[model samples]
Target: MSFSIIFFFVFFVSILFCFSNSDEVYVINTNGTKIIGRKFFTVFEDKPYAAFWKIPYAAPPVGKLRYKPPNPLRWLDKPVYNYSIPYNESCASGRTEDCLYLSIYTPIIKHIFDFPVVVWIHEDAHKHSPDFLIDEEVIVVTISLRTSIFGFLNTGDEFAGGNMGAKDILTALRWIRDNIGHFSGDINKVTVFGSESTAPIVASLLVSAAGEDLFQRVIIQGGSALSPADYRNYNFEIMNKLYWNLDGPFEKFNRTKLYELLSKSSTKKLLVASYDLFDSTEVRDNQRLINSFPLTVELSGKGAFMNKFPLEVYKRKITNNAVEVMIGYTNLDSLHKLDGFVRNRKLLKYLNYNFQYLLPFEGRRDEYGSKLYKKIRRKIMDFYFVNGTVGERSLRRFAKYMSDQVIYPILRQATLHSQVSCNNVYLYRFTYQGSFSLVWNTVLRNLNFSGATSGDEICYQFKCKSLSTAYNAEETSNERLFIKKMARLLGNFAKHGNPTPHSSDDILDGLQWLPLNPAKSVRLLNMGRELKMIKLPEAKRMEFWTQLRNEFFPDRRINDEL
Candidate 1:
């Protein structure tokens, strides 16, 4: 945690993180500003990458640093950082806090020194950008913080000293382990990846000791560590601020009346007192601010990123940190649609309107009761649509029972509790459906849909020229051998934490991918076309939703975080 030593300070270019890749010409100096990078490739593939745009590590949460956490990043004048200004344009009217900012890329190969860093924890908010696996020579970072109420609005007390969006991802990996060795990168081969809603902030920075060696390896796709809005404790920060004050205006904003009005307001008057509790369109609506916002529950001392709860810190830090894991999903990643349910799927008002949009806490479905929520939505539509009905003629078995009711009991309980606290865990189930899941509908004039949902493998690992403007040489050779077999299994699991590629053939003839054995019987794998690894594609419907969630909510909080 020490790096700020680029003190040979001179001046030529002032930003964009250093320059040139051909005939080498370099210069980097993190945090005190001054970087220069540029050199990209991949119209079809030529490798050579080296991006570096907008690299401030932190500082700039603004004015008395609202809700404070991230800090480092010394000076700043500002230059590149503009992934299309907060998701395609609209800055949602306020709160910006100069957006922390980070990006790095790197891949020019040849003598690859220390290389092996992967840091990309973005998600749907501000629509995650940084172009897929930066052509994987590995070093590819991408960051930014302050989402909803500037990082999950907490304040259960102590002038809000909690989870500042996982402390702006541990102060941007402590400025990439003291400035990623001037872009050759390799803080002991960091990995910390994420997908769909930042995979519970990378499984809350993998059961934090403030994310120990900064990272070792963990790749969660389609989320885990009980992701979908996990507040492990602080009793969900007083049930997310009284579930946003029972329709807000702080049904008496607790934490002892907003600790002197949030230490004397003005982060735009505490975000206009949380948008004046949604201008009382009958208070805190929009699915109660999308099921009461997300993330926040750090509090519990000394530079905390996560104090507990991710299966009690992955059962005491996964067998003493031998830490290496890879998780995945996407066999119809949560599918369900019914705009006129193909002209009435037994319209029990469209099967109770897509079974109240396939429940998963539709904001606490009025705490169950409409005759026990139609007898728990008819025991989950007769345990998945057969004699219990759902017919636009069983829409592909209702999109595989609404995509295994949102990805098989939280990725089969985070791969059976990280393979019984880490002995090794790897799992996949993408099952291809590319061409960006079938695009091309010149404004609904034709083909606009298919499979591949929940974060469509980020359009086959980068290069989504709007999914396809042309791809007919065997679909451009199966999209360049599926983005070089997903960058040789995420750059051979960021240089050998194991995704197999022993001296690479760029996969397909060197296939291995094993390691998830809930007691045998496996065979399968892929998103490019053909790859198999069996036994898990709804293993008897994820064991009937894990024995119906251990016979209904057996002490839920995702069964106390699995």
Candidate 2:
């Protein structure tokens, strides 16, 4: 045979061997439900790993169950679940009532039986596999919960108490606690990790009474339940618009009638009405620093996820006091939000005229035209603008002004956790700008931005095929080095409850990353061109906000009491 023919024969034999070597894996939960899964190779190293995808842990929240807490699944017939294939995409990309499924990936190497588990909760949790992290000899899980109005609509009573999204997450956690061990995962070493928009969920789980003892560690980045944007009352005007769009008598309907109409509406109609309420220029005008679909204080009951606000939960020590926490934020978390101002000069003018919008929602709750409201708004304008107006010239300052709203809440939560929790609180600032800067390149088109944006760190933490096109070439030395560092940092935390714990590794370069000492000062490791421990970045601005909150919005209460 010729040389080409010989090569083809060898390749064909290798393919056959690869297929023959693969095996199907199955696990039986404590409840006696057999779940069938498949084994796959990692993206980079091609090492074998097991994946169980799209396994339902809760009953579908459809029909009468809409807007209610998730119900634990019942295997009435003792069925065998053959979830050998993955879903088409992340559930966040679609609108559905039956989206409460979770996927698990575990290292299947010989002699590795019980690995640390990292439960990932993100809006785009399923867009990419955790192949890279799996290569680090850890088990990874990605979970999906309801989103948009379907997950948060409330009439403020037992029928529709809201926070169904949060309750879904809580149910998923219970499932992991009971079922993860059969898949070679250590339930005690579970670390609940969330990034960007999902950070609030992780933080909320940290403080909720229902979340106690479910997980031992947490990693939250770029969000906090304390952020005004994440936790607030539903916009009543938007609720009214939704009712009107649904063709229901707006305010005249009783709570029971409202619940009946919402639970019975079609998913398409609900989505259209939700979009109608959201797709408008005055969204910011009406909502004013509030998240469009915000997490609410659920009514107290057997299944209440968050009966009290997170601050009160922390104050009263109704939280997991021994759970170690790794929390931080990017330098320019809100940079992409500025893309609108860059395109619309009209918005800049509106911003200047409506300076009160710059204030936190807590400040906005103060009556308009009140003395404190004016003082707070004027103080923010003067501090950020420095005698200038909101325009192209002040874009950088405005980015800081916008990003601070996100960062302050994270810092506040870190401080509170450090003070009250018996375990250590490790905080860091992710400032590394890699080639795949999601916000810098995709959203802003690489407009001379230098810092990392909110979700930029995710590309380094995982091998995402969707983001591969962002790279102009193969991974640069810096990108590889950064990825290794991130894996080591997080993997160390999951296994040993410390990132640098002695730091004999070459990647960390003997960096001893210390935890927060809020009693003295808040120090953080700045992950950047040079990794060094530094005093909090933007100290002056942080102090300004701390003083402002102390003076104007001193206390946070649920129903005006803890």
Candidate 3:
């Protein structure tokens, strides 16, 4: 052969060798069958893994299952073989009830090494699709469950119960525990991680007696157990009333008739109805049912809905000593609520109108409410992006409210009840504000901000395209190091029940990660590029908690003096 021909042949062989080395295989679960997943790299050398898109976790909660608890699938004798595409029907254009399938990613292991398992619960106000979190490295798994009407329609009558989605999650976790080992995962070292709305769902598992043993460690990012205000007294009767208003009047609706109506409704109708209701003040309050204490007997009748009360569950199962917990929130989680506003001027006005009507007291009406809303949104954007507050008053107030109502209380209760070591209950507040050009350009529509906001951390840990879009030179380096740190933190927590070795030196320092204290309000984990701890004044923390208790639970106060 000529020298030129030989050189060309050598170059072709080198390229082929590189391509072969880059390919990775994943094994996923479809019903009771298994299928192979092949992942390849894109032109930018970005990793892309495509498995069957959407799969069902339970039988479609349609027909007889509508408004009732989720029922597991019954196996058939047909030999199951294909895992090439997702098994469930597509989520309507935006959201769907047909989303009941789970995706599994099993990494290739050359040796006999047992890898820890991480199960991710995707976040979308419990209404959107779950395509943003399919990764290849850590055996990423996600499931689609009933949302809105199908998941949480609380009709006091026996026909419709709340928490269908949570029950779906439990079923999925049980599936993982029983079968994940076959995919090279350790059944005992499973860690459940969720972002945004899904975080509370994982917190429910941590506190629920029914779900306590499903996994060993819990990681909640961005969201918490706090419920929306309107749905605090959620019950089947209330749900029936709400449904009747949306669909028709109650006289026209019977339990069986309603179920049939819902069954026939396309998944798109269900999704639209759910989003519509979410926009309503009444529905928002009802959604908050999980956050309050002394849940009415009506709410607890639904088995998994009771899991929403983490404080109550912690009190009852205080001594159940079997799990580890890690909790964190992004600096500008509130910005997630404002992204639509930033992207669309029409949406901003629409949101302002909705929120103004939602607020209980109406002394100042539009002027005060609109101003407050604008200030709050701006503060959220600034803090999350620039890490510099134009003014401290708004952020301080918001932080105080969040801490008093949800974050601080949960941490205090968990610390008080936990029999495990201090390290077992890890807490963090992500403040690493920077910019990801690609992520901003693509997924976020070029909204420039950074430092682990909302579900951003998931992008780092999982090999998903959502995070890849945000890659710039600075972010690329940060992403690689952050991924290693996060994965190690999670893996270590799963292996040994603690986030890290408990020695003083080993504990994260200079980051202001002090122990949680309800009284002094000292523990606030600032997880920015340089972590710091900010101690809320004792008087301020107590005052905020007192105000929240008065507003939400006048009958049960936390003794102002105490």
Q: Say which candidate scores most in lDDT.
A: 2
Off by over 4 Å in 3: 1-34, 39-56, 74-80, 86-96, 124-137, 226-233, 236-257, 278-310, 315-321, 338-423, 437-453, 467-475, 502-524, 532-543, 547-562
What TM-score, over all chains together, does every model reach?
0.33, 0.88, 0.68
lDDT of each: 0.58, 0.75, 0.50
Task: State the local distance difference test value for candidate 1.
Answer: 0.58
lDDT of 1 at 186: 80
Runs in model 2 lying further than 4 Å from the true structure: 1-35, 74-80, 233-239, 248-251, 254-256, 276-288, 344-350, 361-364, 367-372, 469-475, 556-562
Candidate 1 vs candidate 2: the lDDT winner is: 2
- lDDT at position 119, candidate 2: 90
How many clashes (backbone N, Cα, C below 3 Å) per candidate?
14, 0, 33
Q: Write the per-residue lDDT of candidate 2 for residues 1-562, one digit (tens) a residue.
A: 9975686567444434545543554343445555556777775567778888887889988887787789988532444465666675544665567888999888887766689999988878776778768867889998888877867766566666778888788899899998788788898899999888778888887788788888989999889888776776534665667677776544553545555567788887777777745543454443246566778776555677777777778778777778899999999888887788756545665667766544433543655567866676788888888584776577778889889888888888888888888999999998888675656667867466678778888877876668754433565656776777788889888888998886578878898999988667778989887788999877788788777766776664422110
Clashes of 3: 33
Tens digits of per-residue lDDT, candidate 3, 329-351, equal 65444444444444553543333
What ranking emerges by lDDT with the best candidate at the front?
2, 1, 3
Please give the ranking of all candidate structures by TM-score, highest first, separated by commas: 2, 3, 1
